[model samples]
Target: MNKFGVLSFLMALISVIVFLILRGPNVNLLLMAIILGSLSLLGIIFAVISKRWLSGIIGVLCNSVVLVSAYFTLLAYGIAG
Candidate 1:
């Protein structure tokens, strides 16, 4: 994998860790989720453009996991209302 792909994978991993650690509803947590989601998406884009399939795959998986978890948690708590 290229440097960009590696970087992207790392960012996605970090985002996943952050999401797992902050498991409650709060404005700051929401903001962090948005930022991390953006970063993970950017990394996936870069990795795919760089032809780094492995890193891109990893990023996609990590981002998907975080998004799904966050969605379910927020929905279960009725935070959006």
Candidate 2:
């Protein structure tokens, strides 16, 4: 794999480890935010490194997921009320 792939793999691994370490009611949400944030950042990096536009499109999709998840979480906690 290339450098970007390696970095993405590392980012994914970090997210998993963080989730495992923070798997509790009081902190799972926070952990999720950190994971999604990292994923979004990595996606952007991947988008920047690719020669094709598809990679950038995927990055935008990943970012949207992160954003939607954040909004969903906020709504779950009645933060939007």
lDDT: which candidate is best?
1
TM-score of each: 0.62, 0.50
For model 2, residues 1-81, the per-residue Cα lDDT tens digits are: 456644544554554465477656675565466566667577557655754565455545555565566556545556523
Candidate 1 deviant stretches above 4 angstroms: 24-29, 73-80
TM-score, model 1 to reference = 0.62
**Candidate 1 lDDT tens digits, 1-81:** 788777777767777777667656564545655666576677667667766667777766766665666566556446664
The Cα RMSD of model 2 versus the native structure comes to: 4.0
TM-score of candidate 2 against the unseen true structure: 0.50
What lDDT does each candidate get? Answer: 0.66, 0.57
Q: Clashes in candidate 1: how many? A: 0
Point out where model 2 deviates above 4 Å: 28-31, 47-75, 78-81
